[model samples]
Target chain A: MAKILIVDDSRTSRRMLRAILEEMGHEVVAEAVNGEDGFVKYKELNPDLVTLDITMPVLDGIQALSLIKKHDPEAKAVMITAAGQRDKMIKAVKYGAAEFITKPYEKEVVEKILKEVLAL
Target chain B: MIANIIANYLINKGKISLDQYYEFFEELSKVRAKLGLIAVHEGLMTEYQADTVNMLQATMDMKFGDLAVEKGFLTHNQVQELLRKQADPYLSVAQVLENMGIMRLNDLDLLMKKYQVENEMSSSSIEALKSDEIDRIVPLFLPPEADEYVAFATLAFKTLMRCADNNIFPIKGFFAEKLDCQNGALQFVDGDPCLTAGMCGDGNALLGAACKFGQEEFESVNMDALDAIAELLNCICGLYASELSQKRITMELYPPQYDDTIEGVGEYKTLIFPMMLGDKLVNLLICIGEKLEFRYS
Candidate 1:
């Protein structure tokens, strides 16, 4: 299983993601509430995967992803978006997000994406 | 101003501490009550019935109107009227000015009519006003797109109040009802061990209220509960759609439809999931693209 770092501002969302990732046998290395912390965590823990939520306060997922990639060109990050955020998702993809997810999660779809990203 | 009035009233009556008053005021600002009150005033239910339910809601683990309706104290139509009666008390320009000690009642009355004309509000809508509950009406005014989630949930919660014995106020968002279950959707938030699935069959959206919240207590079987469940579906969709605004994919919600039989099955798996809200049992189902069925808490 891949080591993962979760980032988002909502306590509820963070709690939910931690439980699911742990259940899937993935090690949750760290968590951050926004993009700045996410960058710091990525630099420190260097987890195999980072799940970055886009609409957080301070720096957002896009900025965080770019910073992480700049630090390590091969860094893998997954972008989390709300439903109508298609525009942001495209931008994240261009910045080299490994994959994408939507909120109010669906388990299998998440696992499938995680597996796919890990394989890559 | 309404928040201040509520806080002041509660404080003067010694019902809430100063700190609690501030907290309640903050909470009141976040709470949306307009649409639910409109539902009540539009011949939905009697003021007494809604008040009684609202009172019952505050103390016991009981819902407001649902208990009254179940006891045969009020009809569905009456309850719906009561919902409309719960309109925003703060938005009445005259009342706001009067309450602030700036205007007299007669002057306020004349202003109400003129303001109504300027805003194109019907006389009937004005007549539907219940002066005592104005605080409840103003907050429901969200941008148009945001109204879908609020309307669906408000309606669902009102229905639950009319039907159940429990009371739970919505605390967070009127999350839009639409969702995009793209890969890795579950990584953002966590709660409950859940089965994941999806379906793509044509389904109906709810009518009447803005948002819906579903809770099942002790497996009590009520056929009408199906309507409640459907309303919850609408809330989920609205929240999902709202979250996707950043992606620029706008989703239009279709009205809810209902038929008697459960005849068709699709490629998606079906699982019954549970969500815990205090003592409430929240059963949720996830369907993807008309194929897989999954349980979600």
Candidate 2:
């Protein structure tokens, strides 16, 4: 199992993603509220993977993912999106998001994405 | 219907045990049972009419639609519509599998069509449900299950996962004439079929969920908290409407409203799906064919 950092504005989403990550036997190293917070946590925690929610109040997921990737070009990211956020999804892919997951969360898809991303 | 045909074919070829055969049909009937409830809920038949037909089914060896029609409970056209519901088993299951990101779209559709062709079942009926002809977000058979009244479970589960802690679990859905709610938010799913969807709760549970959703600690369940819940509902409902649009169904979403004044929510046949968000309980209500009425509105 790998370590993970969850970044989303909604506390509810963070809890849910944490629950799923932990259930998959991955350690949740840290959690952050927004993109800036997420980037800071990413550098501090140095987890194997970071899951980012695309929309946030301050400094959204894309900006955060970009910051982390700039800091460490090898950084792996998974973008979380609501359906029909195709434009944001394309941007996430451009910024080097390893994969994408859509909400509301489906456990099986989350597991598969993690497995493929971490190769574990 | 596709599931049964394949299961029977495999059993006849000695591929699966007779035990597996019975298990398959037992599970198949569970899916079919929801059709009867949906028929009643859709006003295609009365509860008494559905029940009498179900009772006759055991002794008569007749199909459900034929039996209902023979008893003068439904017209031939109504039975055809019900058959459309029967044709949806594979597509319903496929939607779940697709949502899980495990299967390609139309894989199950093609597979079921092949099975229907082999069994000499009506392929046109299957296509009718899948065609531009039927355009609704919630199909005759819904995802996670076939019952329309219970279909909100998927949305409720998603809402809680997005706005509340993941430890929350849903209680089985049931028909409630009225619900006592101190704080509530509701929005109408207008157009095509007039309906209402809302969230209602009081005390710790609603407040806790609202706090997480809003990222704030609230002392009581107020309009602010209700507004947060309403916003979550609105977001998902918009996505749901978007999905329906792809199917060519036009739906109207009204502005979500929250009220602390209503003592209760009721009117029409309200389908309530209760959930335990940690230690507190909240209810997700959906009223089909009519708008929800608030007590003391």
Candidate 3:
């Protein structure tokens, strides 16, 4: 299990993700509401994995992902989103997002992705 | 109804075990709870009324809401309102299964038509009646299992009919502060004690329903139903808050959270209440302090 950071605007999503990750024996090191806070938390906690939501106030996921990569270069960040953000998702891939997960998550899929991202 | 048909078909074809069917049914129950909560939030009726109807429907051949109306508990307009408040379940499910283009609309339509015939509604008079007319005729389908999927599917079907029948957008989403008034509350995980705080949302005809419903039936609020209900509250909050904020309320909303079973003892009373949805009781726990202590049942 890997240490994880969850960044999302929705409390429900964050809690759900925390449950799934913790259930799999991974530790959720920290969480942030927006990409800006996420970036700050990223610098402070430096957890093994980060799940960043693409659409957020202050700073969006792509921007935070860029900032994290700037500092760590090897930051393993996953972009999370709901439907209709296809363009932004494509951009995250280009910016080296470790993976992307959609909203209304499936536990198994999330567990598998975390394991895959942590392996690297 | 469709699920049972599909499950039966699968059973006959030797595709799944009976145990799998039971598990699916259980999950579907959660979904139904979610839908019932949404309907209540939409101001269709009170949680107790919905619960009463759900229980009555169990032993009798009657529409859940219809039973309530017959008992003089809810007005026809209220039943119509509840029916109108429903959203499309197939669309929700489809959104969840974005990758699988498995079920076609036409196929589902045929299944529905077949279902209509199987129940022996062959009279041209019944067929000619409008969709809403048919809906009033059969309020609840009472499948072998009342699950989340079934509830969602039922809501979707009703929503479509309502849209087609009424030609109106029943509700729209917006974020504002009057909606954000502390008047709207969060139910905590602890025992029956509630916090009387302002909630974020648009204060409208709906506020009366939210306040009354929140206060009436639930001691420990139902989370799944609350999430669905809160989505409307959020929309109402968004619209109401936008007007109050002058600037849009920039704060983001977290998804709905819930826990059915909790055990503890404390004087720092927590505010979470239980609201009725159909036959199920759902709880909503308000998170105010820095951390929430919880254990799931």
Candidate 4:
């Protein structure tokens, strides 16, 4: 099971992600409210995986992923976004994000992506 | 949505009893048929052909008739013929009422005329509502000045139906200075011109949506339920933002926020569309071109 960190401004998204991760036997090590906090938590907790939301206050998922990758080039980060943020998703990929998941999280897809990201 | 609006209006106007209204819908539901089914019954297409078109519809966003033509199962003229034969929801309600001996055909016709005159609706507008096309029907409910937001409203309603509940029925919308609710989720679009939109309700207005979207059942409206509501609003805004992106318009969406208190937000005028979910009332709130501030009591 992978140790995960969730960074999203929505409490609902965080809670839902936590429940899904826990149900799948993954350990949720920490949670952050936005991109800046996510960058901080990534350095402190150094989780095996991080799920970052693309649209957030302070800093966005792309910036946070860049910072996390800079600190640990081997860090695995999955970007979370709503359906439309293609431009942001492209930027996230350039920053070395391992995978991406859309909002209104589907359990099966989440599991499949998580498994693939953890294996990588 | 139009059916619900007319039924509610008739009930309130004393033209029809609440019991009669419920009975009418119940009977109508039993007889209401889908387009594919109608096409098959009319022998325009075989059952297997209709089934194939239905399956395609689940994956594609196109209408059944359009898909049928695309699949080469029917031509444009045949599809149009089938559409003409498709039952109009309002007419179905009237037919059910007559069939059930609730009202005579002549009396129902007079009542329909009265409804049109009382609501100041043109027959063409009524026909648009009967068509059940979201794009066409949403404008009739919203103020003409807010025409630019019709696309946003249409997307929001379609998303609500697709993700939350399909049984929702929308009522006419109006411009208002303030709206009060027990709980709500708000999000803002920031860019060339700012926009703010939200959904709010009293009691269990959002409870069913929360349960459906979250796939969890809660006895009451709580933080978890509100979270589901916020997620839904996020999805709606995300879609609207995507549509804007296609037009080369860039807009940033703020993370959704929610509150439980009833408050009046500052001077911006809001377009409020009230919708019925089962037995509860929920309102879709939209404000354009200005930021809003709320006054808490």
**CA lDDT of each candidate?**
0.50, 0.68, 0.49, 0.80
lDDT of 4 by residue, B212-268 (tens): 887789666776787788889989988888888999887777777777675645457
Better of 1 and 4 by TM-score: 4
Runs in model 3 with CA error above 4 Å? B1-297
Identify the superior model by lDDT, candidate 2 or candidate 4.
4
- DockQ (C-alpha based) per candidate is 0.09, 0.08, 0.03, 0.48
User: Residue B169 CA error for candidate 2 (Å)?
Assistant: 21
| Candidate closest to the true structure, highest lDDT | 4
Runs in model 2 deviating more than 4 A are: B1-297
lDDT by residue (A18-105, candidate 3, tens digit) is: 8889999989999898899999999999899999987666888899999999999899998886533455677899889988886547
State TM-scores per candidate: 0.37, 0.44, 0.39, 0.78
**List of chain A TM-scores, every candidate:** 0.97, 0.97, 0.96, 0.98
What shift in Å separates residue B246 of candidate 4 from its native position after superposition? 1.2
Ranking by lDDT: 4, 2, 1, 3
Q: After superposition, how far is residue A40 of candidate 2 from its true place, in Å?
A: 1.2
Question: What is the TM-score of candidate 3?
Answer: 0.39
Considering chain A alone, what is the TM-score of candidate 3?
0.96
- List residue ranges in candidate 4 displaced over 4 A: A22-25, B6-30, B33-88, B91-101, B104-109, B218-223
Which portions of model 1 show Cα errors greater than 4 Å?
A: B1-297
| Candidate 2 chain B worst ten-residue window by lDDT | B132-141
How many angstroms is residue A40 displaced in model 4 relative to the true structure, after the best TM-score fit? 4.4
